[model samples]
Target chain A: MRIGELARRSGVSVRALRYYEEQSLLDADRTPGGQRDYPDGAVDRVQLIQQLYAAGLSSRTIVELLPCVSTGTATQSMFDRLLTERDRIGVRMDELAQAKAKLDRVIEQVLAAGLTRDGATGSAPVGS
Target chain B: MRIGELARRSGVSVRALRYYEEQSLLDADRTPGGQRDYPDGAVDRVQLIQQLYAAGLSSRTIVELLPCVSTGTATQSMFDRLLTERDRIGVRMDELAQAKAKLDRVIEQVLAAGLTRDGATGSAPVGS
Candidate 1:
């Protein structure tokens, strides 16, 4: 497999793939003629990297955790770190939920007002 | 209130407040020496802007929607847009949940494996 195919299959940009390689979170072999040759595993590897990144793991942390995660093994330190990361994700999820609820209230209020686009305000309920 | 005061109250950077001003998501009056003077309401306005931004609104969309949201009025278009934004946030939350679950599985696996830090693997149940 080549880098472009890996990027396409993983749904990540080639630039990001390169950065992953630089971070040691991903690896590819050099071909005899100086091109990058990725094994089939690279696709899954890139996707995993994305998942960890989305889970709020920094690149350095991902580098540290990848081997243990891939092998289904973890040191006590890694376990502790994973718990902390999980709590952080929970905090972020709560923030997003709060934002969503605020938007929902605004949306509901506007709907009750019965307004219209195109420079027109619909007749809202009259003194109800 | 001055710009710095607004930033302190809103918990956003002075630079971000300026950018919000540039995007018209925020406004302030000019003082005699050209310092920006924000009304007391500006604190709440900036916090609202932060919430909308967290809800994944572009600055332009925030600019368009702020008046209706603040006034508790909404055009039909804005209502539809808000629904879409809410849906997008839902999808993002689902993705975050999935990532957390994946990490949970990994953590559980490692715990069951009973690994330890300091280059030691803890003892696991023998043939259980």
Candidate 2:
């Protein structure tokens, strides 16, 4: 497949596909006339790269780990790094959860005070 | 207290406090000596500002919503904007969760393939 086909199928832009190749995260073969041709597996590989990016892994780190993910026979260092990123994602999720909870509390506090400002502090009963 | 004291109490840097003030997310009175003097409540306000920042609200959005959180009597539009930010945070959390799950699946696939490469594919029994 061509770059456009891969981009269309994988939901990534052509410029991003070119960037992945530049970063050595994706591979394509150049034809005799200088056109790039990609294999069918490039689709899944691009998706995998997208997932790692979404998980906040940098392109350098992704390049390092792509081989392990592609072949599954990498050294312990790569495996450890992958676990570290997974833990980082967990930490981020925890932070987001805390932020959400804080927002919830702020909303609650604002509404409570708003009620007071509206003279409904002591007038309304529960569920009334 | 002065800006440094507020920074210590709030666990935010003096530079960031200044940035918050510049963004109108915080306030301080000037002393005769040209120092920034903050009220005791400034500590809590700084913390609230940090929480909103962690929730991924931009300075612009934070400035727009701070009045409602501060006075509890903002217009309905402001309240609705706050709700919009809350919902955006929720959406971001969901995206992070999905990304994490994808990472987990990739980790599992790598480990499974690593086992196969180690010649343990069909020979290993559970707990053996």
Candidate 3:
């Protein structure tokens, strides 16, 4: 399929597809006229790449792991690396949760403080 | 306080504090020799700004919200805006968690498929 078709099917832009190719995250064979042509599995591969990106994996890491996913044969060290990546994602998730909880607490405090001030000070001075 | 003292107390850099002032996220009154001097609550305010940043809010958003936080009195619309921001953070956290789960599933699939391949194919070829 042409680049446009592949991009449309994958829900990625033509420019992004080209960038992906440049990044070696996606590849397509050149046609006789020099246009790029993709095989049947190209769309799925792009989807997998997008999934990896959303999963907090860098393009560098995804490139290294792509072979394992495709070949279905990874070494013991590869498994160790995957486990390490999983743990790193967990750590980031925890940080994000902590940040969220901090914000929640701040909002709650603001609400309670505003209520008490309104009761004591008889309506806070409003600004535009 | 001097910039260094505030930096040490707030756990932000002198360069970053200057940058924050430039970005209008922070301000310090000029001293006799034109050096910056911060009031007592400046450290707490800087910590609050850092927390806001970690909550995924931009400097611009924090700038707009700072008055509300400092004045200790926000209008009803300001409260609405705060709630909206909180909801947005919640959505992003959900997306991050979903992405982590997708990665977890991919890792699991890779492990299971690798085990099956090793059992049936009898020692898969390892790549460097």
Candidate 4:
């Protein structure tokens, strides 16, 4: 398939697809006529890239992970390494959860203060 | 405290502190000598900004949330709005968790495939 098809199916923009190729996150073969040719698995690959991008992974990180995902291999040491990587992800998940909690707290604090301000002032300002 | 002190205490760089101020995420008063003077809670605010940045929130988002957080007010409707904001944070947390899970799966797949390759080939290549 062409780039357009991959982008459309993956819900990623054409510009992002081109950027991913430039960043080495995606690869496409060149035909004799100079058109890009992609295999059937390209759609899934693009989808995966989109997911990684949305997850806030850098393009470099995605490029490093793509091969391991595509091949699916694990020696003894590799299995241990994968476990470590999984643990790192767990840490990041915790960090994100913490941030979310902080945000919630901040919002609650603000709402409470806003109410107090209005009650004491007897009228809320336009901006408030 | 000085920028260096703020940076050390907050675990954010002096450059980042300047950047944050330029981005309006942090505000500082000036002394008669024209140096920046931070209030007592500046460190906490800076830490909050760093947390938000690490959680993948943009500077713009942090700026928008700052006023509400600093004031700490809530009317009756404000509490409901705060709840909604918390829900949005919850959604973002879920998305980040999902991304981390996907990364773990990809890593696991890669490690398994690598082991299979080594087993079948009797020896793994340099790149593998």
* DockQ for all models: 0.58, 0.35, 0.34, 0.48
Please give the lDDT score at residue B122 for candidate 1.
Answer: 48
Per-residue accuracy of model 2 over A1-128 as CA lDDT, tens digit each = 99899999999999999999999998799999898899999999998888778767899999987876666544557677778887888887787788777667767876775533233325332233
Model 1 agreement with the true structure over B89-119: per-residue lDDT tens digits: 8877787788788778888887677665547
True contacts kept of each: 0.77, 0.43, 0.35, 0.69
- Give iRMSD, candidate 1: 2.5
The lDDT per prediction is 0.80, 0.77, 0.75, 0.70
What TM-scores result for chain A when each predicted structure is judged separately against the true chain A?
Answer: 0.84, 0.81, 0.76, 0.68
Task: Give the winner by TM-score.
Answer: 1
Of 2 and 4, which scores higher on TM-score? Answer: 2
Query: What is the lDDT for A20 in model 3?
Result: 83
* Model 3 chain B poorest ten-residue lDDT run: B119-128
Candidate 2, residue B102: lDDT = 65
Assess every candidate by TM-score: 0.82, 0.78, 0.75, 0.74
* Worst 10-residue lDDT window, candidate 1 chain A: A119-128
What is model 2's DockQ versus the real complex?
Answer: 0.35
What's the true lDDT of residue B11 in model 4?
86
Question: For residues B5-100, could you state the per-residue lDDT of candidate 3 as single tens digits?
Answer: 999999999998998898898888998899999998999889888877876788888886776566555666666667787787777667667766
In model 2, state the lDDT of residue B32. Answer: 94
Q: Which residue runs of candidate 1 sit more than 4 Å off their true CA positions? A: A120-128, B119-128
What lDDT tens digits, residue by residue, belong to model 3 across residues A13-89? 99988988888888899999999999979999998888677667888888867766776556665666677777876
